[model samples]
Target: MTSITRLFDFPYYQQDKYISIPDALVTKQNGVWVKTSTEEYISKANAVSRALLRMGVKKDDKIAIISTNNRTEWNIMDIGVLQTGSQTIPIYPTISEDDYEYILNHSGAIYCFVSDIEVLRKINLIRNKIPNVLEVYSFNAIEGCKNWVELLKIGEDETNQYLVEEQKNKVQTEDLATIIYTSGTTGKPKGVMLSHRNIVSNVLNSAPRIPFEAGKSRALSFLPICHIFERMILYLYQYYGVSVYFGESIDKISDNIKEVKPTVITAVPRLLEKVYDKIYAKGTELTGIKKKLFFWAIDLGLRYEPYGANGVWYELQLKLARKLIFSKWKEGLGGNLDLMVSGSAALQTRLARVFAAAEIPVMEGYGLTETSPVISVNDMRNKGFKVGTVGKVIDGVSVKIAEDGEILCKGPNIMMGYYKDEKLTSEVIIDDYFHTGDIGEIDAEGFLRITDRKKEMFKTSGGKYIAPQLIENTMKQSRFIEQIMVIGDGQKMPAAFIQPNFDFVKEWAKIHKIEIGTTNEEITADPKVIARIQEEINRLNDKFGNWEKIKRFELTADIWSIEGGHLTPTLKLKRKIVMEKYIDLFHKIYN
Candidate 1:
C-alpha cells in the first residue's frame, strides 16, 4: 500500500506548497541541468509579479505567454500572473501569425512573454496590428527586449515579502486564472476562461484516482505546457512533491526518458502509436525462435484482461513472456516507468491492451479543454480498467448521453465561458451542462467509449450515415497506413486518401523484390505499391458495413502534419482542410 495522502480541496495548492517544500524543480538551461528549489521559484515569481505591478499591471488584466515548455520560467511566470490576479493567456508558439494577432487582440493582453528569437520575431511582425499589446518580453535574453530574469532582479525586495504573501491570500478560488485559447479542428479558436476554482477542483478530484507514490515517483515533462492537460498534471505533480524533469525537445523525449528513468509520464495517442509502430518494426528484424517468441509475447499481451484471471497455466506463460520480452520493452521506456497516462485523443484499443499486457500500463482518458481537460480516466489501480473505454466518469462530475448521443457533462471543472464570446458560449452550454460534441455511450460498468465526433459523421447519397472516425481507426490498424482520411459526404460511396508508411513499405518492397522509384511521386504511382495498398484496404473493408466500406482509395507519399495545416497540434485530422487540399485526388477516385 502506497502512503500518499490525497487532498480533496487544493485552494492555495501551489502558493502554499512552493513555500513549504523548498525542494528542487529540475530544468535544462543551455546544455546543463539546473535545479531551482521551490523557495527560489516562489521568490522569483513574487519578484516578477512586483515588477508587473510596478509596470501598471493590475488585477484582472490579461497577460499572454507564448512559449514552449521552458519548465522553471513557465511555472514561475504562471504563478506570478495568477498571484497578481491577472489571467494568463497561453498560446502555442507554433501558432500562425494571424492567430497570434487575433488571440492577443481578442484577449486584450497588455504584456506578452515569448520563448525565443523566432517567437519574438513573430510578435514583432504583428506588434503594430495588435495595439493593445504594450510590451514583449523574452524567456531567452535576446537583444532589444526585456528578459524574464531582469524582471525578478528589478523588483527583488526582502522587506516587501509580506506583501507577496498577502497577495497570495487575497486570491479567491473563484478568480479567473487563465484564458486558454483552444486551437480546435473545425473553426477559429475560442478563449476558454478557467477559474482557479475550476482547475483546483480538477486537480483535487482527479489526483486521488491516479495511482502514484508521493515522494518516490518522478515524471518526465515533454508535452506542451500550453496544453491544459500537461498544465493540470503539473499541478498534480507539484501537489505530490513528485520530481519532474523537463525534456529538452519533443525529438529528445526518448533520450530524456532513458536518462531520467521517470516513473510516470503523459502523452497523446500519436506518440504512443509511434512507439507501438517502432516496437513492431523491431520485432520484424528477429529470426527463427526469437521472432516467434516476440510475436507470441505480443499475442499474449493482446489477450490480457485486467478484470478476469486467465488461469494458472496462462499466467505461467505470461510470466515467462514478461521475463523474455516485456521486461526489455519496459527498458526502452526507461526501466522505472510504472504506467503512462494517454489523453487528447482516443487510444487504439489494440495498443492499449498490448501495453497493459506487457506490464507497461496505459490509462486512457477523455475530455476537452472546456472541462479542465479531464472528465474520465481509467484507473489502472482498479480491477475494472477497460481497454476500449475512457474509463468511468470522474468524481465531482456528472455525465449524460443525450438523445442524439452527444456526451453532456455537468461539473465544477467546466469553463466559466468563452472569453468575449457569450453567444458562442451559450450554444454549447445549456442549463449548466456543457455539450461535449463527442458521440459516445456509457456501458453498465460505467466505461465511456467514444465512437465519433458528432460533427464529423456524414451521410452518403444512399442515406446511410457513416462515422468516418470508425472507418479511419480500423484502417490505421494496417501496417502500411501512416495516416488516412475517409471521404464520401453526399457521394455515391466512400473513398479514402491514405498516406503510406514509407519506411515499412520500403522494407517490404525490398523483401518482395519489387522496385519502387526513387521519388515519392513515382513510388506512389507504382502499380505494385498501389495494388499492395488496395489489398490492405480490401481486408479492412470486410470489417465495416456496406455504407462505411471504402470503395476506392488514393495513396499519397505526403504525411499529414501540423505545419501542413492538415492536422491540429494534437494530431487530430483537420478534415475540412484535408478535403480542400486533396480535392483532385477525391475527384480522381469518384469521377
Candidate 2:
C-alpha cells in the first residue's frame, strides 16, 4: 500500500501504474495452465502486434471479438491492439441482432477476430450493410476466413525490433482501450468508450479491496467477458497475476471448479441461485437420513446467524452443521472460494446470506457500464458487508444522493462519455458526475442500498408509486416461482407475470397424478395448476396493500432467456419489450 496522507487520496496513481502493468501471459499447453512470465507475455504481445501491423491495422483503428471466455486469444488481441494504439470492440456471443448491429456500427471496428464460422454466418447477415468492416479473422480453422495459427505465423519474425518499440511508445494511459456497448434492456445498447485509464483505474481501485494473491488465487471464468463487469475483473487478474481457467461452458463450470480449485471468481446472481437450486435438487436424490441432514444443514445455514443463540454448545452444533452440510458446497466450489463477488445485477439477500453463512464470502457490488462498471464493492475485511447495500464507494470515488434519489458518482472510474451519442451522454453525465439510473440511499455508515431504478418505478391507477423490483425480490423467496415480473403502470393494482420452476412444478404435478404432457399455454391454463400458482401469489400478496397487491397474474410456458428475447445478455428483464409483447394477455386479464 502506498502511503497517502489522507484517506481519500487513494487511487491517485492507478492510471499511471497501469501504463507500467507487467506483460505476463497465462497459456494453456497440453491441458495444463502455464504461467508465461512478463518477458514471455511482452514477446507474444509484440508478435501479435507485428501480426496486426502486417494485417494493416492502423492507429486508433477498431478490432472486434465474438467469443465466450477464450482469454488466450481475447487478451492477446486486446493487448496487441492497444500496443498499436487501437481500440478493441467486444460483442457478446448471446447479444440479439439489434445489439450486434449497433455494436459493430457504433464501434467503427474495421476488422474482426471471430471465434468460428458460426459467428461469421451472423456477420454475413449484415456485413454488406456494415461498411466499416474490411476483414475478418477466425480463431479456429474455418474454411472461408483467415485462421488464428496462420495469422500468428504472418508476424512470426520474432526478431522484429520495430514491434517492440511500437509496444513501448505507441500506447498511452489515456488512449482508448475498448469501446464497450451496454445491453440496455429498456433501450438500444450504447457504446461506452473506455480509455486505458477507465479500465486500468477500475482494476487498480478494486483489486486491493478483493482478496487476491499472485500465483495463489485462480478463477474459473464462464461469464461473458464482452461486458465490463467481467472485463474489469480480467484486467485485475492480469495486474495481480491471478491465473484464470476458462470453464468450457456453464454446464462444465462444476467439473472445471473441481479441477482448478479456484480461490476467487465472480458471477451474476442468477448463476449462484441456480447452484443453490442444484444442491437442493441433489439432496432430494439422496437416501432418507442423509437427505434429512442435508436439508437440515442448509436450513440451518439459511436461518442461523454467525453468533449462536444458546451459547457454546449451540455454536459447536452450528460448526458441526457447517462441516456436515455446507462443507460439500465449499467443496463443490473447488474447496477454496475465499470470495465470490457478484455484480451486473442485484443479488437476492436471502441467497447472499446463506452463502456467507456457509463460510463462502459473497461480496456483491454495484455499478453501471458508464462508470467503467465499478463504483463500490464490499471488502472481505470490512464490517460493512450489509446484505442489502452494494457496499461503500471504492476508496477514491465520490458518491452523493441527488434530490431525485438517483445515485450520483464522480471518480477516475467514470467514463469520458458515450461515444458518438452526445445528446444521450449529456442526459446522464453532468459536470463530471455520472447520474446512475438507480434510486439509492446511503445509510448512516455510508453503505449504499439501491431501492430500485428511478425509471423502473411505476404508478397504479390511483397514482401510488410502486417499485416492482421490491415486490419481485419478496416474491422470489418462494421455491415455486423461478422468475417474476410485476406490472401495473396505469392499472388499478399491481399484477404479477410469473414463471414457475419447471422442474419443481413438473415433479409436483407427477406426484399429484396431474398428467403433465400439456404445452405451456395449456399447463398455465389448467384449473389445478392455476389454483396452485394463485395460492403462491396470494401468500405473497398478504404482505402488501390493495395498491401493491397483485390483482391478476399469468404463468407462461416459455422461459425468459437472452436467446428468447425476454432477457438482456446480463439476464435483466426487458420490461418494455416484455410488456409490449404480452400486452394482449395483460389486457385480457384486466377485462
Candidate 3:
C-alpha cells in the first residue's frame, strides 16, 4: 500500500520539483526502438529549435502544430518553439476545416507542423484564409509537404545551438506560452492564453496527488494533447521526468497499456465507460460457474464502498475477489497501474466509487481549459474522500462560494485571459478570480459537489429550473443509451433524444432470436429494439421529477461521432449542433 503522508501535503498537495530551460523532456522515438532520455530530449529539442531558426521562426511568433500523438516529434516541435521563445498552437486531429481556419487566422500562426494526410489537407484547404502562415512541415512522409526527417536532419546539425541558447535566454515565466482555443457552445471559439507560470505551477501542484516512483512511472497518453488537461499533464511529465508512452491510436490503447505497463494515466468519462463495457462483453462469453462468479464479483464492485466500515469476513472476501478476479482488470490495463485519473467532464459517482473499490481508484478531477485544466482532485489517500464530491481545491488556489452558490476560483493556474475577448474575459474574470460557470456547494470537509453548469440550468415556462447535466448523467446509466440530450426551456416538461448503444442492442437481438438481416434500417425498426430503449428510459425516470423526466424520446439509426460533427474533439456533446440536427424529432415530441 502507498503511504498517505507521501501522497498529500496540506493546501492542495505539491512538490518542490523544479523545471528549467536545461531540463530534458522524457520521450520515445518513432520505431519504439528508441527511448529518448531527458538528456537526449533536450538535445533533439535544441536541434529542432535550430531548424525553426532556419525556417525563420522568431520570438513571440505563433507556430501551429497539426499532428496525431508522436512523442519525439511533438515534444521537439513544442520545446523547439519554446526554445526559440515562440508560442505553439497544437490543434486536435479531429478538428474541422472551419475551426482550423479560425484558429490559424485567429492566432496568426506563421508555421505549422503537420503529421498526417488529413491535417495537411486541412492546411491546404485553408491556405488562402490563413494568409500569414508561411511554412508547413510534415512529421510523416507525405507527398508535397517537407518531410519530418529532413527537419530532424537539420536539427541534428548543431549549427544553431548558439542561436538556440541565445533565444532561450529571453524566455521567462510571465511570457505567453500557448493559446488553447476553446470552441464556444454558442458563438465563436475563444483563445485562452496560459502563461509558463500557469502551466509549470499546475504541474508542480498536481504531483503529490498522484503516485509517482521515479523511473518506474509510465503513462499511455491517448487524450487529445491539444486539450489543456492532457497538455498540462504533458508538461507535468516533462518537468518531473515521468515516462510518457503514446498510444498508437484510439483502437490500440488497451494493447498499448499492456506494452507500456503504465503506473497511471489520465482519462475522461467516455473512455472509462468503454473499458467497463469491454469487461462486461467478456463476461457474457463465459458460462455457468465462471459466468456466475464473474457477474457476482462485478455486482459487488458496483456497490462497493471504501469510506464505510464492513465486517471482517466481507472485507476478506472482497480482498480475495480482487486478487482472483479484479487483478486481471489491472493486468489488462498494463498491470502496474497505481491510479486512473479522470477529468474534463462529470464522472458518474457510481462509476468512480466502483473503480476505487475495485483497487483501481479513479481520482476524479474537475476543472476547465480556462483554469489550465486542474483545480480539484480526489486523493485516494484522503480519509474524507467523498463519492460524489470532486475533492478539495488543489494547492495554491482559493475557492469561494458566491452568493448565488457559483464556485469562484482564484489561482495561479487561471489563464491570463481569453485572447482578444476582452468583453467575455472581463465578465468572467473579476477582481483576480475566475468565475467558473459551475453551481457547486462546498461541504464542511471542503469537498466541492458540482450541482450544474450555470448556463445549462434552464427554467421552464412555469419558472422551475433544472440542471441538464445532472439529468443527462443519470439517464446515461441505461444500457440502451449511447448518448442523450435533455431539452426543455420554455416547455412544460423536459424530453430527450436518446442514441441507443447499437452494439449492445445488437448483442441482445442475437440472443433474443431477433432477425436484423445485417442492415441498420431493419434493426432500428425492430420492436425489440424500441421496447428495450423505452424500458431503460422508464427506469431512469424514477429519479427525476415528472416535468424534468424524459417525457418523450427518439432513437436514431445513425451514430454521432467526431467525424459526424455531433460530438466535439474532446468527446463532449456539441449540444447546439446535436439539438439543431434533430429539430424535427423534438418538434414532433413537443407537438
lDDT of each: 0.85, 0.76, 0.77
- lDDT (10s digit) by residue, model 2, range 416-465: 77889899889998988999999999999888898998889998889998
Q: Comparing 2 and 3 by lDDT, which wins?
A: 3
TM-score, cand. 3 vs. native: 0.93
- lDDT at 370 for candidate 2? 83
- Poorest 10 consecutive residues by lDDT, candidate 2: 6-15
- What is the lDDT, from 0 to 100, of the residue 88 in candidate 1? 91
Superposed model 1: Cα runs more than 4 Å off: 1-24
TM-score, candidate number 2: 0.91
- Give the better candidate number (1 or 2) by lDDT: 1
Misplaced by over 4 Å in model 3 are: 1-33, 155-160
Q: Give the per-residue lDDT digits (tens) of candidate 1, residues 274-326.
A: 89998998999999999999999999988887754778777888889999999
TM per candidate comes to 0.95, 0.91, 0.93
Question: Any residue pairs clashing in model 2, and if so which?
Answer: none
Best by TM-score: 1
Error of 1 at 288 (Å): 2.0
Return the candidate ranking by TM-score, descending.
1, 3, 2
Determine which window of 10 residues in candidate 1 has minimal summed lDDT: 2-11
